[model samples]
Target: MKYAALTGISPSVIAELKTGKARTLELSSAHNIITLTETAPGECLFITSVNEEDLAPGDAGIMVDLLVLNISMKRVEVTSSFAFEERERMSARIKVQFRGTTIARDVEGRKWGDPTKVEIIRAACYRAG
Candidate 1:
């Protein structure tokens, strides 16, 4: 099994996780920390981790990075007019990259004419094995 490691924490934490500047940490460290936000119940906490390792053929000991998390989004809808006019549904996709590696991806659908917002609810990271 793999574990999540804590690298750093933000000093100026925000009521909402999305509102504050992200803190950076070294990927070689190991620790776990929980971050809280001002969102609703079941929608306010976030987590992340990091680890170090060596996988390069010659390097012998290189640190790879990994990140994981869950994101939330506000509901969206398409207006009848827009749907009829464009004949397409509104959609969004998220892509995550770590040390030049694609780790995870997700897509969500949105209404043609509705306001939409998303939250990265959870995330974790570690050195690639």
Candidate 2:
């Protein structure tokens, strides 16, 4: 599925992709969002990611890079986010509710710190896999 790149990226990053340069966006030692493009079979962009965001005592979570594929431009168009909670020992779970390209938002509809993002992240884990 197609989704927006959630974090506001630097102009340099956008410039790199438009130039057909391959680069990786790293959030940590373990999380990476790689940018790739195809030149022959039509212009296609890929934002491949491998990330881990929720890490806490007695629980951990992992997300294999979700492939944002066959893109045509440097910027994606939909809102997306990921968050998680520990549902078991050394296990993180995102409740099976929220899914799709949505950001956790405030009651006024601001994407502040809504817990719904946890479910969205969980869904990404499963759907991407």
TM-score of each: 0.16, 0.24
* Model 2, span 26-80: residue lDDT tens: 3311111221221122222222121223211222122123322332223324444
- RMSD (Cα, Å) for all candidates, in order, is 16.3, 19.9
Question: Which candidate tops TM-score?
Answer: 2
Candidate lDDT scores, in order, read: 0.23, 0.25
For model 1, the stretches where C-alpha displacement exceeds 4 angstroms are: 4-70, 82-129
Model 1 TM-score, all chains together: 0.16
Q: Report the Cα lDDT for candidate 1.
A: 0.23
- Candidate 2 regions off by >4 Å? 28-109, 114-129
Model 2 shows how many backbone clashes? 1
In model 2, what are the clashing residue pairs, if there are any? 49-65
By summed lDDT, the worst window of 10 consecutive residues in model 2 runs over: 89-98
Q: Which stretch of 10 consecutive residues in model 1 shows the poorest summed lDDT?
A: 54-63
